[model samples]
Target: MSLTEILSNFHISETTEEIYKNTIKASEIETPIGKLIAVADDNFLYILIKLKSPDKVINTFNILQKELSSSIVIGSTKIITQLENELTEYFSGKLKSFTIPMRCLGTDFRQQSWNQLKKIAYGETMSYGELAVKLGRNVNHARAVGSAAGANPIIILVPCHRLTAQNGHLGGFSCGIDVKTWLLQHESKFKNK
Candidate 1:
């Protein structure tokens, strides 16, 4: 399917932001959970979705799509292939870190927040308040951190699923709490190995 069609299929609205028509490459690969949709430029993998539902996919795509000025083609690149391989290893519990080149788009704080999310170790989690303090923000910024976490485009590679509530509650995950729970459990299996 075409990029626009794919977006529409997921119930994403046509964005008012400039749509880049020819430079984006995307691919759909089936995974243990469901289909994963990935998009990338020549040098950076920009979007990766675990495909829980249209809402999360649309939210993530909209954030990354705004910066691209070309149409998204369904094909694989060296970067895409590497990402697929890494994801395979990850789901199989053999990979602990992702080495694929990636880029994120968002405001400065949001970008900083996503970058910090990448530092959360597999099978470990921290409250949003802890993340805010880690980011050098006062505790009040926890909500802002949560917002940025919600907007993370790179999903598992960046590990936004590792952020939780101060009381140890799984706050909210763009994909769904069940997926978040599964990811944490999956990572925990390999944590002490």
Candidate 2:
């Protein structure tokens, strides 16, 4: 068979096996609340979601693998090790901010919104409307800000849980409302320390 014919018969799996060989290291990290599955490489820490169930794990991997055009394997890297240490300090309230590099993947609007999330102080909270104005949008854009916050993948490091409703209700979290509550309370306890 000619090379053209051979290339035509190539399957995605076969292509994936040969060409997209970038290795993304992942690890299941334990936290006081639950397990967190973190994906990272030498340069950037990608997704660090609170572990849910078996199905969710597979689904998360599938989505990220396709986007990165790389294989996610069970292992550790310098970044993951750093993240583990930082998380430990954070949970104990010793660390107020994260210095670990993160690569956020999303639309331009979402990127802008998530960046704003990083500026929220450890114990302080911002309302969706306040965030929208910071993004140069009117109060009506609050819902859009909320959506971008919900899509944040780096969890506590990104600090989306620090956002609250105008009436003092905690907004949504990709993890869970309970997890969000815990994170907020935890930060409040250590804010002055």
Candidate 3:
């Protein structure tokens, strides 16, 4: 179904002085990758995210749809939409990681890192040191690269959880390490499928 159709199914009512206040509709679509959450407001696509949220997953989509109904189409991807669905199910404790197409905006280097992050495959991880080397940079650049990873606007769909410290410690996450740990364990448990 279309995004509008999905959003129309929700009961939305709220007002925010924040920029997201002008939204029109929002929706969540399930995909092989994860749950794709999209917000459309004032003719603009405000936020599209993929992640697991026990309480906010469904609510966020409804809220966003009613907030940004007018704005620019920030980005679009059938893969992302599909991923959203998968993630929603997973977050609801029904599934695991996802495989889907996703799009993001950032600097050249940040974009590169984000793209590489997507390839990190579920249940596996790469130390910042290893990531720096894969990016063809000296291991010393690991910290800098880690910073870039943290700045990633799109979180889970980018799979930033696959990155960690050299000692296999969960480092930092833009969305919170608790979420990261959950994702890692979830993926690891169902990775082979």
Candidate 4:
């Protein structure tokens, strides 16, 4: 699928943004939840997604290879290795924050929203309305923020799962509601460990 198709699958429109180009390395890392395809360069981690939609996501690597003006190779980078270690520690309930350098390749709004997402403390969650307010927008923008959250490419590292619906519902996660629920539960169980 093309980037537009991927964004549409997330129920959001596409906005072009400038991103650095390079040979983006790719690898599949296993987690307690599932398998994740991590892509990055020497400078920054670009995209990371669980293989929920393997065909679409795998094709994304190809699409990104073109869009990024780079080649996608089946290997890993230093950033990817660091991310894998962090993820292992995260699932083990020993890591509360991520230290990996993440690059957001999206619109200004989406980037801002993702930055706000990165602020959500590990094991903590908030409503979309709260996140909107943090972004200096009113509750009305909650839906927009939610859409941006849904389109978050980095998944757990970006912490999009921390945003809930207005009524505290586990509304949606690109990885599946089950994965979202499991993440929240895992965090809750080990937050103070």
**Top-lDDT structure, candidate number:** 2
lDDT tens readout by residue for model 2, 1-193: 3222322342347657686779888788989878888889999998888765445555556666778887766788999999999999999889998999998778899999999999999998999999999999998898999999877778888889988888889878778899988888898899999
lDDT of 4 by residue, 1-193 (tens): 3333443343211222223345677778889988887889888888888877856575556556556767565678999999999999999999989888888677899999999999999899999999999999999999899889877879888999998988988888888899999999999999988
* TM-score per candidate: 0.86, 0.88, 0.59, 0.85
Candidate 2 structure lDDT: 0.83
Question: How far in Å is the alpha carbon of 182 misplaced in model 4?
Answer: 0.4
User: In candidate 3, what are the lDDT values of residues 36-99, reduced to their tens digit?
Assistant: 5564333333345554543343454433344334322234444445545666776655554455
- After superposition of all CA atoms, the RMSD between model 4 and the true structure is 6.3
Q: TM-score of predicted model 2? A: 0.88
> Could you tell me how far off, in angstroms, the CA of residue 153 lies in candidate 3 after the best superposition?
2.2
Model 3 spans > 4 angstroms off: 1-81, 89-100
Off by over 4 Å in 1: 1-22, 53-63
Better of 2 and 4 by TM-score: 2
Mark the regions of model 2 whose C-alpha exceeds 4 Å error after superposition: 1-12, 53-60
The residue pairs found clashing in candidate 1 are 20-69, 20-70, 20-71, 21-69, 21-70, 21-71, 22-70, 22-71
lDDT of each: 0.81, 0.83, 0.60, 0.81
Selected candidate, larger TM-score, 1 vs 4? 1
Residue 191 in candidate 2, Cα distance off native in Å: 0.3
